[model samples]
Target: MASKQIQCEICFKEYAVGYCKTCGHIGDACVDIHNTGKVFQTHSVIMHEAVNVHEDDRENPKVIIRDASEERCKQHATERAIFLCTRHDTMICGRCLHSEHLSCGKEVVDLLREVGSIDCEKVNTMKSLLMEVKNEILLLKDDAENSKENFKTNADNCAQECIELGIKIKQRVDELTNVLIDEITKKHNENESTYSRITRTYNEKITWCENEERKIDQFVHNNMAGYLYLLSRKFDKGVSDVRSNLREIKHKHTFKRFEFKENRVILKCVFEDLEDVCEHQDEVTGSDDGSVNDVFEPTTEIQKTRRELTALSHKAKEYLDKSIKERLTVEAELKRTKADLNRVEKEIIDN
Candidate 1:
């Protein structure tokens, strides 16, 4: 039968019977010999440089390895971070230990050890806080949506009330104006009738006096002295009667101009009061300071509804602020947890 053959991994030499005399056994012994040979090669290089370099120039291989293996401190960019300053919640280099963190009064732990010693309990606590904050935010969102709908409803109601009030005011103004116009028109018609009657009576009196004068003139012209003398007293009596009637007409039907003593001051005051009502409505409707009750003077159901809406708005604002605060806290904790998890993951990979 043919002997089994194996190859040395380090020397790449073929062997028989699971061993090679030149490179030792094929499995564990050859692996150890190869590793020891690498260590000697590294030691020889270090020793050769140590003989040629000054004591200060000879950097420790461990420090060089650590510096090469780890990330540098951000604050001290050229120095490798070796410790975690718990007080400042920062990774620091060896130089920072003797400088900024010397009297910081907190534990400074080895970064690798600290990463290895991460407590799952703290991560769970952070998760719990995050969940609570998320739930609170969701509740706040629901409350905000409800508040928005309620505010819209309140606004619609207030607008309807304003529109109704405006209509009523216009109607009242029209009623008052129409009543005054009607009264003035009636009075004007009566005054015109009285003027026409008096003018007609005065014209009749003038016509009768002219006819009597003409009769007197005809008697004088005809030289009928006896008849004229007899008719003189009648004529004078007729003239006197006509003059008396004229005087009576003048006294009874003198042209009296119509005047409307409308209560304009009272109307103006009503308008001013209406303006005040309008302004109060604006104040009530436009207020955002949760002062609806103060602005609207809750004497009616609409005002009471507005007050309730304002109270709801205030409550919504409070809840929103609380939710925001919780969200910020959760985000901060999540950031910290992520950084811790990353550190733990990196440590695991390194180990």
Candidate 2:
């Protein structure tokens, strides 16, 4: 008898059915695994009760160990199988009948001495299954061949899409840049027209003031009080006009300047978006969430910063543009002061 949990001498694996009566080697014990043969009997009831065992069935392989081609029980590797589990509807070993049926308790375990034989219908059904499996294997090989072609096609499409998308992005950026340039040009032309108009107005005012000064100089030999009184009202009105023009230049006639602000974060996000698209092509579908879209819709803090910068630039431009205007306004004020001084001198003479 073969002991439990011992290695099979033929396959060198743990567990076997029984030892040969002649050679004493377990599992398929013939001249192929051992050097002995010529067995007259089999030892099937070593630890199990002999059921349906007969003397006339000595040469048959059905009872196991009666012939050398006895198959091992696939369900029970370490024990003789004679029990049929009622719950699972499968054959199990002698140990399984006493133990649990898949740990469902021994109450559901049952034993039956069932027999199986291949008739014409059974043979035909098995043949059909074998053919179906063979055809499926051939179809699997066809899929393997088609996979290479499909991969190449998909790769080429991906490469073309990448290049086309890159070109579109470049064109989009160029179009946006041109729009900004056009805006700057339009503003520049408007500012130029305004500056030219202001300059002509200032020139006309200067001419009027110069004429008044010449008249006052010529009236020096006349009755001093009477001449000075006639000129004071006219002089005051002229000074008021010059002061109003200077105030307009200071408050309303400023040229709004535009500055190009570079957002590195936008460029960084684009690069990262591209990388993310490539990393998970199957997951990341392209949406309209480009970085340029947010550039026009600036955050409140960013808009505030831009406004502050523009204010600073306007101040700088004012300083640059008012260099000549400052001199003109000061000259007009000085003329008013001199006229007052002249009137005082006349008053002193009269006293």
Give TM per candidate.
0.54, 0.34
Candidate 1, residue 215: Cα displacement in angstroms equals: 2.5
Pairs clashing within candidate 1: none
Tens-place lDDT per residue, model 2, 1-351, is: 212244455566534445543323354443233433324334322312233545564333223323211323455555545555566776566566556565656644333323343367878999999999999889867865776677678789888888887898789889998999999999999899879878887888889889888777777756577777798878888799888997888688877787888799877866775664433234221237632212233223333344587798999999978987999899999999999999999999999
lDDT (Cα, 0-100) at 246 in candidate 1: 77
Give candidate 2's error at residue 188 in angstroms.
2.9
Give the total clashing residue pairs for model 2.
0
Best by TM-score: 1
Model 2 pairs whose backbones collide: none
Q: Assess candidate 2 and give its TM-score to the true structure.
A: 0.34
The superposed Cα distance between candidate 2 and the true structure at residue 29, in angstroms, equals 59
